[model samples]
Target: MIDLAHTPVTSVPGVGPKRAEELKKLEIESVADLLGYFPYRYDDFRVVDVAEAVHDTKVTLKGSIYGTPSIRWYGRKKSRLTARIDVNGVYVKVVWFNQAFLKKKMKTGETVVVSGKWDAHRLQLTADRTWFGQESEKHVGRLEPVYSVTSSLSVSWLRKTIYGAFAAFGREIEEVLPQKLRSRYRLLDRARAMYYLHFPKGREEGVQARRRMVYEELFLYELKLLWHRKQEKAADKGMTRRLDHEKLDRFIESLPFPLTGAQRRVVEEIVRDMADESRMNRLLQGDVGSGKTVVAAIALYANWLSGFQGAMMVPTEILAEQHLRSLKELLAPTGMNMILLTGGMKAKEKREALSQIQMGLADVVVGTHALIQEDVIYRSLGLVITDEQHRFGVRQRSKLREKGETPDVLHMTATPIPRTLAITAYGDMDVSVIDEMPAGRQPVETYWVKSDVWSRVVEFIGKVCRTGRQAYVICPLIEESEKSDLQNAQAVFEEIAEELAPIRVGLLHGRMSPAEKDEVMRSYAAKEIQILVSTTVVEVGVNVPNATVMVIYDADRFGLAQLHQLRGRVGRGGGQATCVLVADPRSETGIERMRVMCETTDGFEISQKDLELRGPGEFFGVKQSGLPEFKVADLLEDFKVLELARADAAEILEATDWEEAPEYRPLREYLDRFQKEQAKFD
Candidate 1:
């Protein structure tokens, strides 16, 4: 087998230094990368009789040039070449734009083939590609791969280069999937799949090739994830905690409201994981206002009952303070020592907090990334919980985990991921979802309105505040930008403050300092500010029960998940809350987003819709979410294949000697190379 990874694209025929640079723009530097660069779409150039061809449809015609092609120049570098073709007694007019050079190639009464869209109204065919008599037999009547190309590259050149590479190395292409597995799945071999992927005989062959490639991509990714999980489980010895059922029952009973069934189930799952001999790496996913914080507090209480320190890391200091306050209130009956540690804390305060954490006096510590700092020492840290886990990178989470001796890590996120994303993105960790809302929690009434009804929206906000409740006015931007026409927080704050005089309205944005943002949020939570005009910074953990009205301006500017999160800030209290989406969307996608938000409050459904509309790259932000960018597999469309790959990977790893078995040697080698590539980025 050829070493495709080490083989340069420059080794291919017609690929000089300049051509190699152009190929690099498409991220194809090596022969392997070039082979993986699948076409986005294909153009069918099957020959068709002129009489049988439908007008206004793309068709290829094989015929003899009836006359000499003539060229007419209209402007600089602009010319039109017109010709007549006779296909078995039927004559058709053909035109080529800016191809004056074709005049030399188009000979009178010469056999040629053309592919283009035939216009019935104009009685002409606008030819896109032309080939001579014998060449047409090999080039036409097949699916031609149309690649995404840069300015310096042409589709024909890329196709020819890929063909050349295949001719040289096709027989040497190594298979990564085991023969038994491929037979079971009825998948095409790697070399055949690559050929059919770029140049297929029929649509079914193309589909089969694509399915095989997608499955292989997802299967390898799943293998890597499961392998890492296995390594971690074997490397570390987990702490098996002894649960105090009596104290846990008392704590549950002491809550103001009864636990939801879903909450209870997830808590039980977590407690079971803590008591197990295997270290727990789990994801706790819940929608906004899903009472996840209370569940997390209970988990921390359980850790305390086991006589171990627990650290909760949040994204922002404001969220950290909020968690500290809420955990303190929830754990008040047990007298657990909960302390706050943030980067903004004073020198003396930081020192005291650090000393308490190191001395084991702090039972439940809530803070931002400050908890993972080098100087901060933990005394018997047993559990580590990260809120809004997407905000932190893999290394940051690892740093926090390294703080303790194989601490049980629980990742929490308010962003309810779709099942497809949850399985793939968090494939390394076990996932627990709190899908139920607490009893008596009201759903926020949502409405969509255009900007022409801004007056009515403002009046509604005023009426909501007049009833002794708070409101939130969300804008997409903090300040006016020359590029965007969307409403900004400062302008909206000024407008609302003047519209509703005597009602305190506050402005909060990311541009504000931490202290300033925290002060604004504190005042809003205290009900001193009847209306808070802010950006999506309040989309995560800001909880004000009195804020029953949410008015979002330019709602189309935000994604469906973000809009849902913003609406969740309201409807947390007993009273009926309302969310008004003010938007004048231009595109159908924007309009659909608004419609979806107004239609339902289910974050998972909204997330699935978001995944469908924005795709996984934007939904989970592959760069930050640590999701691998697949070349052929789509997280939404190819979810079934992903499920199969994940299951198959698990079964394969269950075999103790699979790693050493000759049958699995190719997969092992591929995984070894993949890890080395990943290590470079790390």
Candidate 2:
């Protein structure tokens, strides 16, 4: 009976091997996969009158066909089925393109229900779905789940197969949550939740079912994270360092700028962590120009003073070089030896860097992934730092630690995350946020304007360039293609150059070779490129304090955190900076996003709004983030449920040994199975 989870999808009624192949495109190969496959949205198929249909909106209406749908041929092979429907003296033409077979199902003066978009241009309804004779009770006047599909699969068929599967096997579906916990939370039974999630009677029941399912997903994820943290704590035997406050102060005072209060507080936190016997696994999160690098340097300096080596890994060669140059200037004055190692370096140069690191002659080494190579050994490595923490996964981070004897790890990200997101994404490590910007750093004045005003923005860029300031023009795509309608960097660069002749514009994109990209970046850094047009590749540590303007075309395509990062590229030089968002959003949500971007430069506040607007999957980028792929949970909408689930898991852990307890057998089994499934992806 337990093998039902892996039963082939073809075993379901009406789903043969051919249909199973189509389902496989959706990652639904087994019964369990089919069950877990969820709808992206729902369509309200409640009955209404044809006269009440809103233009350009999807609606369902019941009416009598005035005559048989006539099949007409056009453009050689194209066919259209056209018919007329009358309801209470209102007549509307209904059309279905390339669906000539639909004409066979309809006859003159027949009662039928159709759901589709009502187009006002032709005074017609484009019928994408129809129910013959009488509306089915299963769908009419109810909330209908709309599954995402491939070209070969239909939502109608998929919905029917799911309903049939539930009728056959719903009772056999295991309840992963313990009965006691479910009762305490007032959650519906597992079988009931499953039924309502896919075939709800109304919006209220649908929301309730979604809440319960989301709680289960978050609860499982939280348990796994908490368990991992517990294990790490049990195994920790970290460095216990004694710091020289006088030496640290001398290094801080020698810096070109004074440290902000927030920076000082974070440095103190690091010092406390390093002095403890347990390993320091902390995440340092801050906004752009919040001075996180300085805090990292202070920690590395403290490690150096304790007679140990330190290493910092970045994601790109340019960022590694930038860090090397900055750290050399800052730490060398205090007699610290810092060396740069990158994959692009000559073989002989890399050999020398590795030799110094192995010989303990180099106090600090900064590089890209080259620092983690097998040949580059550290003699007494006591500290490891990874910048842009999201770029590296858990196992890759562990590989860096393998170089040292479980050295204290400090991960850094400039991405300002919301509170609930921080709790879940970085549950395994302690988090410290530098919420305050350094004194004297100017907030970039942001504006959201229509794309039609490109000429005005270009004129403003020209003015800023004449003042000896640089600018960036970011596009969502690298190049235009037939597949996408978005504006691209290459075309925008040409347009900008034509509009503002002799402005010395440069084009940069991810498709360029490393050498090409580096050359373009060098030009921009030297103030040679007055207007640099590029993609989000420039969103990271491309620091040019001279750049004062950022013009993001189609800015609505970006999330709030991304917009903030792009905005951070400017306002680094302490003078006035501006971020112009050129966008013409179609949806209300898209317009609201632009409003949020223009309202404030407070990253945390922006992040909260972003989380609220776009659910966690989209806000955090489901593909890139370490967050789990949930079937029903939404980090933004179900935050309260997440808190409760976390508390329940903690209570369960403390109450008994869940592995051996009979009441927790189902939970343990589910977790074990989940781990096994995750291992396949790992």
Candidate 3:
């Protein structure tokens, strides 16, 4: 048996260098890659009797050519080939468009099979695919796989190439799962499953093959995650800290507001993890304004009491500053010395901060990626916290953790993810969610309006402004593009400023410098700018309680999660707030997104809907979130299979001698190969 993973696609009989280049466009560089490239759909070509065919439904028919086929050219490169077929003594008109060569192939008394839509009203059959006598025997009785191909590669050619590859290397394809596991899951053999996946004799067989592939993909991923978790625990010794419950209770009491029940539960979980001897890697997730900051502050304070320095990293400088201010206020009673470090800080300020950090003077340090730079040092770093954890890559988080001596890490995200995604994306870490919001916070009132009602929305914003409350007018684009029809922030700012006189509208976008953005945000927060027209830069960590209304233009252009996040910017104060979504959505998906925004404010529910609509790849971002892309598994549709695979993977890992046992040799070998392949990219 050859090593398929190392063999190039050109090894296949018909695939030359040029053909291999075409395959490379589909990410099929290796024989294994080509085999893993599953078809998006299957075309059922099973023969059906012409008399039994229904109107407008696709059916395959076997018949004899009753007369000579004729071709009529109507225009350049366009022609219609018409013929009559006799099926059981019944004559039916068959039409083929742009297939002039078929006229020469079909003759009187010739047998043929055609798959197409049956038009009962017109008493005709429109053929999409045709097979001459011998070819019909191979295709007319089974489901045909349809591969997604570029224009240079036809579906027929790709299908044939895959079939040839399977015929040549079918036996060489190793079964990664052990025999006992296969029997327990009722899965087909790997080689058989691959063959049936590409060419199934029946629909049931195709479904079974797909199920096997999905389970295998998910099971391998779960195994890798669980194994990493086990390795992390075995490799690193964590700091065990005293809880100091009395000190922590006093610090919590010093806060301006009380913690929600969910926050208290998550706090207890984090404290317990900190008290344990093992390293803590926990994810703290909650909806916007859910007091995650307070909980994080408590954790940092607890770490301070444990007599170690704690560091907090955020995605942006603005968010870093905001956290510094809020945490300072929350933990002021503890007399914990905190320092700020960021890329935008001046040379003198940064030097002083770095010196303080190295001298152990900075008890709680907060900053952006600057904290992870080589120059900064922590004297006794014990706990690491990253806010908006999805925004940073895995390596960045790891770098921050590496700065300490096996420090306990807490990842906090305002974006609430569904349980299925949590299980897959953050499988290596324990998860804690703050599902409750603080008291006195009201649900933002939401409404969907068309472009024709723009006047009314502007008037409503003016009314809100007159009452001394602020509003946000969000656009999808920063500046006008000749190619885009969506509203831009600059243009909308001008229009709204004119429509609502003396409302003090200010424009903020990504194009602005950090200092300029800070100034604009400061104005908005101080009530100097009543309406801030901006792009999606305000989607995260922008808290302005006085902003009572949010009007988003071209809301259809944004995803449900984004829209929910944008709406969260408002309704933070004691006053009732409203969100008006202005969109003239043309597609059903866009319309449905708008409707979902108007229906619910639950971040988790909206995220689930977003996953179903846009899938996991776009939920946050596959690459950014360190999510693995699977060939046959769908995180949304195949969630139950994922759960089963996760459970099985955990069970296998629990065995004391599974790694060295002969029964798990196949699985162990596959994992070794998988890790080596993964290391190449890393």
In the range 371-488, model 3's lDDT, one tens digit per residue, is 9999998999999999998788789999999999889999999889999799988888899998887888889989999999998899999998998999999999988899999999
Ranking by lDDT: 1, 3, 2
Ranking by TM-score: 1, 3, 2
lDDT of 2 by residue, 412-479 (tens): 99988887888888788888889998888878999998988888998999899888889999999988
What's the lDDT for residue 539 in model 3?
96
Clash tally for model 2: 0
- Candidate 1: residue 404 Cα off by (Å): 1.9
Model 1, global lDDT: 0.90
Among all candidates shown, the one with the greatest TM-score: 1
Task: Compose the digit string of candidate 1's lDDT tens values, residues 1-682.
Answer: 6799889999888889999999989999999888888999999888888777898899888889996778889988999999998989977899999988888887788899999999877668999989986878887779989999998899999999999989987887898898877999999999999989999988899999999999999999999899878877888779878989888988999899899999999999998889888899999999988889999998999999998999999998878988888898888889899999999999999999999999999998899999999999998999999999888888999899999987899999999999998887788889999999888888899999999989989998998899899999999898989998999998999999999999999999988898899999989988889999999889988879888999999999889999999999998878799999999999999999999998999999999999899987888675666677888888878999899999998888898888688989988887788779878997
TM-score per prediction, in order, is 0.91, 0.74, 0.90
Error of 3 at 585 (Å): 1.7
